[model samples]
Target chain A: MELNLKLNLDASTLKADFPLLGREVNGKPIVYLDSAATSQKPQSVLDAMDDYYRSINANVHRGAYYIADLATTAMEETRSKVQRFIGAASPREIILTKNATEAINLVAHSWGREYLSEGDVIVTTIMEHHANIVPWHILCADRGTRLRWLNLNVNGNLKLDDLDETLDGARLVVLSAMSNVLGAIPPIRQIADAAHEKGAVVVLDGAQFVPHLPTDVAELGADFLAFSGHKMCGPTGIGVLWGREDLLEAMPPFLGGGEMILDVTTEGFLPNDLPWKFEAGTPPIAEAIGLGAAVDYLADIGMPAIREHDRKLTAYALRTLPGRFGDKLNIHGPADTSERGGVLSFTFGDIHAHDISQVLDGEAVCVRAGHHCAKPLMDTLGVTATARASVYLYNDESDIDALADALERVGDFFG
Target chain B: MPALEDLYREIVLDHYRNPRNRGELPCPPAKRAKGFNPLCGDEVIVFVEVDEGGRISDVRIDGQGCSISQAAASMMSVSVKGKTLSEARELERAFKTMMVIEGGGSPSSPADLGDLAALQGVKKFPVRIKCATLCWNTLSEGLTTE
Candidate 1:
């Protein structure tokens, strides 16, 4: 796809919408580059959450009062918003959880527990976050199942040459849509198609993908999609698990409590319905409403525009970082901007990532420095940790320039 | 805001650039303990050979980490070598006290911390305190274990 200049993603104007962006750190303006970890919430999302707490503060589903109805409506409205945002078949298919990790865990506990057994095989990639990898590891350990890893090539692309062979006997395929560390966007649609042809269910970890790029569940060909609200300018406690309606109906309740059951006598209880059967306790009411506002904010700006902005910023970083530092910088992802997201994980000379991060903090340029919760991928990359600077819709060339400028300081300090 | 120089002192950087006693000892004679900071993937392996006279005969540290962690381990190795196990324990206590005290104050007693005193600046950077303490904790583990 070509970069469309018609998109209205002015980073300076959008930066004003997020209150946290206005703050200063260490006497300098905060240049946040850790959006892959969590995004700064916009004023609209904060207002939506504040409004819920201020006006419609009540327990959902149980209270019969006026505010209770408003609370329930506000929360459920988020489900519909997420459903529409991802183009899900229905809101019933969207199960709200604490975060993307819990969303993936729900699939492992509810669906994997029922379907998987001894001799079954699960296929996952080395590039997945621990959230996507560990749940399947638990299920495999529990059920005596085997896990097959799909390794990546030197350029960080998945080795899809033998994808059919890998998916031959796999019962389920779990992988990240975009690597949190490498920023490599795997060919999820092609992998999903291959998995389906082999009669395997595809579980997509969209935590990193959903926050940056335009996403459509059907287009991705995933049986289930999991993403977090916190990474997308929403509240921390809310996440989404979008599954096929029939698949969710067939799975058992993940957590059992008051709201998940219809009739709870002395005997075993019947699960409630599609989404509620999974959401056990009183959900994150204000957080869900905040996520709804976040969805509205992104929709208003348009995902395409946000994506184009990310592309431009990423392309600039890809060029500028290497152009300035030459062989001193080693960026660990696909070199092409088209094949990657805005995440820039790199090692500058022999300086350790933490030391680099410490120096960057002195310049008020915030970046993540660690294994990024993907230890297995870290092993594959042959590095203990990397300094990561990820761009978002509110980031522009100036942010990238600041990152490059700060990196020069790293060279001066460590050289 | 703590300056970067506060966290990465000249002595700390010196030790980082040229770490001392940075190799593993044979396990049959030396007790080895591993310390890892999972958040940053920093790993430190400490080998301590406690003599029958209760003195730390030799100490070696082998690992990879940021300057703070590596330098701390390097300083820790030099500080405890040839000292009695109890004296080493006292140094650990004094160093930890320095790390934990508010305003990065000196220890209550006049404990001879030597090069380890440079790590008191790490207290200013709260997030990096654990990095300075990782090797000491590992050495403690190594000395205590059979």
Candidate 2:
């Protein structure tokens, strides 16, 4: 594979760090283009968890023993690492949950239920994964709050012309910073500012954005940010929910259990501090440590370089795929790479995405073929499903070339 | 890893490309059932018009999905049309039984399946068994309502 010398980041070299990327599938080297689903873990991240279990295997925050204290310190260090990773004010503002889904649910159940009332408006977008949308749906149903949508334009960008009107009387505005399907990077800062102007809290779904781009909660103007660890080369079963200090302090506890309570009483219980109030049970100790290592690994490479790589690779795909397939292929999302990330979603003729994916799999190329968990966006685009090929730091031009080469066979096989 | 050829048999592709009895039948005379594979967003709507003699006088398949799902529905429409309700049920049970068997079970009697035997290749790809069975499930639901 010839490396593109013009690229800022050496993806070929980066691929070596991820052990899974070195393996083969179907008798050929794997061309993994489904990073948006979940990123491949680096050896460092795997080793971090392995080391924790080997050396510091103990329960966190409860045991009085030296190993337990060490475990608790390690977990707290990861919390501080995450706090700095997203530029949160303090470690207290960062709450750990099962995944991004649980993070959003915590906000919906804790903050939403306490602040919102009947007839209150909660604004969201069509491009949201089911994680960000379903919680609000349940919240609205429970509280009798109205859910308003911010629709997308022809280019898959949010139509903000009616922003003030939509944000009118809205108590909260929830949306994704980067779309999982189209890789469209919406202007979150602009929307967040507008929501703040209307006194509506902005909840940014950073599952796609945090992994691929440089993120600062303050710069993005998000009041609460939610993202998963697995999507960013960290292990699964761990996610982050960063909220404003005051907001988290004011909200009621989400799950009432062991760690969340400061003192239990026969009558009532006192909730713990800012973050511990949200994290109910024994936390994901090693997983959080692994995520900290992932953060360190990404920081060593630098997010700016990663962002640049994503832009250049996405541009190459945006150009090469259509340039090769022509009218037969229809790439959905923004035509401008500046407005997009590394996610490439498209449809080819009448061929179902499943068939396209199956054909691609023959050559050891893995691509996601489904609605991409954005059914409202699928409805808006008039497609039941799309074949999505999302690039990550490990993917390069050769991978894209392999994808195109395999896609050509799809036309041959199905034509 | 089964070859794509095993899943996309020539007969399956033939049915997918040129689907038989495609479209909807009038509701007054025909019963309708819709099936959805929420995982992939594949939908199948099966409509059947049963005669007074308990025979499926007409059947039509309407929906969009992968070649496997669309082909399965198309083949099902052809196989059940003009057949007695009891005969269609027997075919559904036999087809489902074949799907569950590992490595595409060789039916005790291949003569019983006819072209449907080609779908036995589907069992090789476990995730896709749902795709092949979606139409039959919808048809079964429709028959139960009748």
Candidate 3:
């Protein structure tokens, strides 16, 4: 027997904590199902930001004064926390970034684009977000290398057998651990092993995976991993790129500035060591503290429990939607929760995704629509765009009910 | 079978399935252009054969996308075939304006929209606007550069 998941948010807690969830869209309580886009911040993360600003607002890394020292300590604390959260080998392995886009870009521009020789093959999958795909394409374009892809299975899962075909000449394999649209969680550990066997390093796009699933950089066997804080219940404009210590030591710093250098002179340039080499100028001190607090908040509940909650929610959505709408609904990903994460991308009767999204908005049931930055996957799925309802821990079965009800209304409107 | 009105006007389904003038013409001494909506995986190749006095002798399109894109392309081919280049450009602009807004009704009069009017409901689909305008954007591009 399953306990009914309750969305009866404590009014005081909601008002005191989020303060934004109290917002009414179209005169209805907003039921956000677009966690894949980004997540809602908790009160702890917000308070951490406030605490940083109020108490220890100063530049980090090169500071000498008390406040600066505090900021530096907070910054390094976050590095350690992040390193532990992702199971990185060392705190110096985590490089602070602007976003996941920039994290992938650092690898492209710093490692592959600058380091790899011309004509080298870069292997990726059709399921990658444009963040992962475009950077590699740009790198390939600049370096005169070839960028190839492994196609997805009928259920939208990446076919790892294709890796043998793809990894022949590949110097690097970029894999998105979980797709934002299809919600298919690829066998990243297996793919990493294959890439490693082929002497190709694997980079995991953990933007979608890290927030929803339990991850270990070592256990997964990824050489590099990138994720954004906003998607993981933290502040915006902050991301982390964790690499193996040896890899970070070998790759050149992406950005050159005051902080990321050993010494500055008119004669020549000498780069700084490990993580600091890549960090560059003034880092986001307060945001990093907020992210650290967010990690603490998430860890308190444990990711395994959260993943379990989403698994049940996704299974509920898939099973109930077809029963209610029958032939009117078309789910785009795997039929079971075993292979997929928590996304329920679909079409309702004759209602287009855009039309359905708007009607769902009218009912305060929000979801993402369009290609979702995975155009190749969209083409493979034979849909130009789809309305995607992805569940996180905050989302419950009631959220599913709201979405199903609104989808029915959209069907009535367009069917 | 469901009624035509229940799904779409019978003409819409007809256009979507057996699209008219669906193949592209070579850049035959005339203007041609391409357009794509990377967000939706839509690509359009438009070729316009202009007769003397800026009149369109034929306008053909080639592309692959969802039903909205394909049907809109088919409708656009017929809409501009006999019209002047200026008329086609105006229809392109009008079609674009209609697709951006959700639930904005068609051009009020059937004669006002002509064949392109069938896509008026595309306005309700904001994400599908790219799909609806794939052909029109290519036509606009052709009108300007080619």
Per TM-score, the best of the predicted structures is: 1
| Model 2 spans with C-alpha error above 4 angstroms | A1-7, B101-105
Cand. 3 TM to true fold: 0.83
> How would you encode candidate 2's per-residue C-alpha lDDT over A76-162 as one tens digit per residue?
988988888788899999999888989999999989999999999999998999999999999989999989999998888888889
**Cα miss at B11, model 3 (Å)?**
12
By summed lDDT, the worst window of 10 consecutive residues in model 3 chain A runs over A1-10
Please write out the lDDT profile of model 2 over residues B1-146, one tens digit for every residue.
78988889999999999999999999968899999997668999999999899999999999999999999999999889889989998888788878974335555665787788899888888888999999999998998885
How much is A65 displaced in model 2, in angstroms? 1.1
Q: B10-127, model 1: which lDDT tens digit per residue?
A: 8999999999999999996999999998766789999999889989999999999888899999999999999998899888889988998433557877448888888888988888
lDDT of 3 by residue, B1-146 (tens): 12223224456656876888877676666688878776555567888888888899887778765566777888888888889877877776666656644335544345766767676665554556677777877787787883
- Give Cα-based local distance difference scores for all models: 0.91, 0.91, 0.80
* Clashing pairs for predicted structure model 3, backbone only: none
lDDT per residue, candidate 1, A1-415, as tens digits? 1223357679999999999999999999999999999999999999999999999999999889999999999999999989888889899999999999999999999999999999899999999899998898899889998999999988887889889899999999999999999999998999999999999999999999998888889999999999999999999999999999999999989888979998888978989987899999889989999999999888888888888889888999888889999998999989888889999999999899999998999999999999999999989989999999998988888899999899988877788
True contacts kept of 1: 0.85
Query: TM-score for model 2?
Result: 0.97
Computed on C-alphas against the true complex, the DockQ of each candidate is 0.83, 0.82, 0.21
